[model samples]
Target: MSTVADNTTVTEAPVADLTNVLARGPRPKRPSAWSASVTFGWRAVLKIKHVPEQLFDVTAFPIIMVLLFTYLFGGALAGSPREYIQFLLPGIMVTSVVMITMYTGVGVNTDIEKGVFDRFRTLPVWRPAALVGAIFGDMLRYAIASLVILGIGLALGFRPAGGVLGVAAGIALLILFSFAFSWIWTMFGLLLRSEKSVMGVSMLVIFPLTFLSNVYVQPSTMPDVLEAFVQANPVTRLVTAVRTLMDGGWNTGEVLWVVVASAVLVAVFGTLTMRLYNRR
Candidate 1:
């Protein structure tokens, strides 16, 4: 009886130890945040590599817009093709930057839905910042797209009156605005479930915002009702501010407001997205 009891106790001890080990769970691994961010960036680059055609619009659309607008509406709009191209180029560039920001949300939603991000969560890292860094790194592609469009604009005889420094400054401001806009979309992507729905939701807000601004035409030419909206629109202010800077015009208020507004947006959306990411 004593020998049977000892054997049973020995068996029970190993079983209890095994149960405790299983209950304690696997040890969490520590991952470097910067390394994770770089990994996310590489993932983005790989995606871009596979879908090279994804960038067609950025590469081809500018030329098409310049051709169509310069040929079709130039006479009625600006009296000549050259004049129309000059006027339309800035608006097209700004609009393209704004439109490109939409991809940040779409990319995020796609990653989340496709289990790419789920895999990411299994790794120990500053997960939220890793996502943000990925989105920001992708913005570099958008910036390059903008630069390519601008280069084409120059080839089409669209000159900035503000010289090289002014052109650089304009590009800088546009890039900053794009980076800020990306955060809002990132938040949306993190909070949303479906990738396809992101565009619908974003456009529902962005289209009117871009159209109501001084994007395709001067605000003064718009009807009073429309003009009022354009005058007050943040996008309008940003475009005008960039134009003013390029044209060497005085508009300190516009510049100040754009910077302040962009900063506020980055802070608000970035914080909200981080919180939402943690919850996820």
Candidate 2:
């Protein structure tokens, strides 16, 4: 063995040049905005596939909320759970969907903390695709939560006088509002350093918006000053529009308000969110 080793010639193979072997052709075309966003949206959906526990919020939590409110406040509010479910369902759907929008911010913060966003920024794709696509994915979750509440309400004897068309419109408007509303949280995600802080601020803003408004009670029952605030609440307007739609009619004024407010939220918060995202 020693004799063979000593006799063997020390011939080293030459290192291959990866520069020539690698992608020597033209670079692939940059993805279009729609394509990039859809790709990112698929990524978000795939995240849910890997971690199905995320469905808990859209499914179980909404179910719990539907049950808790229908029974807990039904009798006191409307003489019976069945009767109150009619009034309570749409508003609660709004509450649950909007409340869950904060998780968008939490998710953004988590991704940023994990350096996922850092990698995203280095990619050659549409700038806002990640944020927009994340919102698109969240739109699905919002719809799921809305449907969960709606299904639970239906089972609880809640009937939509507006029927299928009305219910569809109601759900459509709610999802649209939730879509625009998510931008606010994305802004907070970029501004905040941690998920807890993002969630805290989101809750602080959401609770007062949802609770102080007409979600649980009519503004008529609130004092004048409180009622004024409730009337001014954008969530109140959205709920009113959704409720009216589900009740077989349209609330022109509230519907207009919701539309205008949605536009404003997307314009303002959307701008701020993009700015922060770029800087971050």
Candidate 3:
């Protein structure tokens, strides 16, 4: 009986150890670079799909504003509605892209508050770059919004003298500017505690930036103080560059300044957003 008991104990020891190892199972492999980016991009796109209202604001508001402004003030400002529509189209495009910054910040805040980013931290991707990729992926929506606005402008008789190439260049410039502005708002979204606060704070800044520029009329037409503000504003430089580009003229200085300003903004705000992401 003693011999039988010893043999049983000896055999069970190895079996028990095998069972323990099996319980733990194999470790999960880290995600690859392509997989991580695709995951992040798809998630971002899905979020946009779920919240159609976010896109509606950009699409619907610009159309309404263009109609209202072109009809109401067009005759008074440009001696005819068609001319006013042309003058206002570029400004509207600039404002439309700038307004997208609000959504950038709000979206970032929503993801953070919901702990979506926390989940991303566990993935094998470069976390900072993932956030940027996600934000940039949304630029597709901005581009679409811009196109819709341009189409409306065309319908309203706002012809671009720059032809197809100039129109394409104008659209490209606005999208690039929007991407640069996204970095700033993304930083704000990462730093702010809530979505509502992000929206409020971003709008508070964007409204003045949009209106104080030569968006509606020539800077010379504004009051002295407003004219000075318009002259000093970077948006004015951008507007001038865009106007020249679309009007089929060459203003190298304005274009150069706008490019430089955009570069500086992207560098500064992009750095800040990365730092904030790292800390988070």
Identify the candidate with maximal lDDT: 2
lDDT of each: 0.79, 0.91, 0.82
Off by over 4 Å in 2: 1-26
Worst 10 residues of 2 by lDDT: 9-18
For model 2, how does the per-residue alpha-carbon lDDT over 164-270 read when each residue is reduced to its tens digit? 99999999999988989999999999899899999999999999999998988899999999999999998999999999999999989988888888899999999
Local accuracy of candidate 1 as per-residue lDDT tens digits, 145-209: 77887788788778888887777777778888888888888888987778768888898888888
Error of 3 at 205 (Å): 0.9
Alpha-carbon shift of residue 83 in model 2 (angstroms): 0.6
Q: Model 3 segments beyond 4 Å from truth?
A: 1-39
lDDT of 2 at 141: 96
Q: Judged by lDDT against the true structure, how good is candidate 1? A: 0.79
Better of 1 and 2 by TM-score: 2
lDDT of 1 at 92: 73
Clashing residue pairs in all predictions, respectively, total 0, 0, 0
Best by TM-score: 2
